[model samples]
Target: MRKITAGVFISLDGVVEAPDQWHFPYFSDEMGAAVDATLGAADTVLFGRKTYDSFAGAWPEREAAGEEDAGFAKKLGDARKIVVSTRKLEFTWRNSEQLQGDFVEAVTALKNEPGGNIALSGSISVVRQLLAAGLLDELQLLVHPIAVRKGMRLFDEGDTAVPLRLLSSETFQTGVLNLIYAPAEPAADAGYEDAKAHLPQS
Candidate 1:
């Protein structure tokens, strides 16, 4: 089965919203390479309606205008784009389509089919749903050093705790962390007895 991976630009405080407001200051060649690697590994891209709208509104025009990042825009344009949405959408971009049927069932079916990896970016809700459903294979976070202090967070209150194992980590030149994680089995709870050994002796 193909893997479903998610990448996000997040602040130290876990804010994942409006990265364009604070993300560029920390961009470096190292960070760019990390992002490129994620994009390079996927043949398909998944998006929530909002993210789809943002990219669809920009990338096609960027590719047509032959902007400096036109190559990247073209790459996105050429990929298979799947948008998760309830309302109907007119997809003007090539190879783009709205997800049909139930979200989990549809995505599971896509994973079971023969294909390269599926990549998701900037879709906080979609990522959360996938993680909750145990369908996300990996989560790649480009964690910036600053704390936005107020915005949408990657993990919210009342969310069921999902255990994750650190698969890999890299510190970029700008102090941003490239952290990769995979879903993990729930760890056994630690009680006072488990911590007693490290308690200070009077």
Candidate 2:
């Protein structure tokens, strides 16, 4: 099965939204390389309506303008773009399509199809849904050093806990951390007696 990897630029306090306001000062060559690696592995891109709108508004324009990021913009424009939304959308972007029907069923079917990794970026709602459905294979976070103190976070208050195991991590020179994780089986619950042996002796 093709792996589904979700990559997000997160703040130190777990904020994931509006990275443009707080993320660029910390961007470095290392971070660029890390992002390039993820995009390099995936031939398809997944987006929620919000992210799709944001990207569709910008990338094509950037590519057309021949900006510094024009190559990356071109890559995104060339990739198969799948937007997950309940409302009908007119996709003017090339190679773009809307994902219809049941969200989980449709995405599960997409996962089973033979293809390269399906990469998702900047789509917080979609990521949560994928995590809840157990459909996400990897969660790659580039944790920046600063905190905006107020924004939509990756996980909200009273959300159900989802256990994840760190697959790997790397520290960039700019104090950013690239953390890769995968869903993990819940740890067995244990009472005080289970840890008594490891307690400090007086």
Candidate 3:
């Protein structure tokens, strides 16, 4: 089975939208280095349509400046990109295939396919689905301190994003806090007062 990793830049309130407005300035050397490090290690990429559009516009041109991450960009351009979507899109990026069937089924099949690790970026909707289905293996959450009163979210399911257990956390030089999490099992008697009252003896 393949390991699926998600790299996200989010806010304290779970906001993962438009970090470019206040964070992730790829022009800086520090940010460049971080991207190089992350991209250099990953062999496969998974993303939602929104992220696919963003990358399709930017990454193709990133190598023009001759940065160290340029090679990674080229690799990204060539690597297999699995795009999860319902609506039809005319994306023409090389080495990409669309996943249009059942969400959970498609991802599970991908994970079972013989391949290296997969990395997801800016696919908040897809992340929500993965979390709902318990398919996410790891999360690289770049948590920024600023609060955006409104925007997209990291893992907001239609009803609610499932609870997560913070496995580890670290601070970057840019003050972006990275929080790692694994899906936590829900309480047996959750949301039921009567059930909680009759909980098993410890």
- The best candidate in terms of TM-score: 1
lDDT of each: 0.93, 0.91, 0.75
How close to the true structure is residue 112 of candidate 2, measured as C-alpha lDDT?
93
Instruction: Spell out the clash pairs found in candidate 1.
Output: none
* Model 3 per-residue lDDT tens digits across residues 1-202: 9888777877778788888886754235554554544544567788888889899888778765569657767888878887887887777677788886888888899899897888887688887778778999877777777787698776544665376788787676767776777788764555677678787878
TM-score quality measure for candidate 3: 0.80
Question: Which of the predicted structures, 1 or 2, would earn the higher lDDT when compared with the native?
Answer: 1
Query: Of the pair 1 and 3, which is ahead by lDDT?
Result: 1
Q: What would the per-residue lDDT of candidate 1 be over residues 117-181, giving only the tens digit for each residue?
A: 99998899999999999999999999999999999999988747889999999999899999999
Provide backbone clash counts, one per model. 0, 0, 0
- Among all windows of 10 consecutive residues in model 3, the one with the lowest summed lDDT is 25-34
Better candidate number, 2 or 3, judged by TM-score: 2
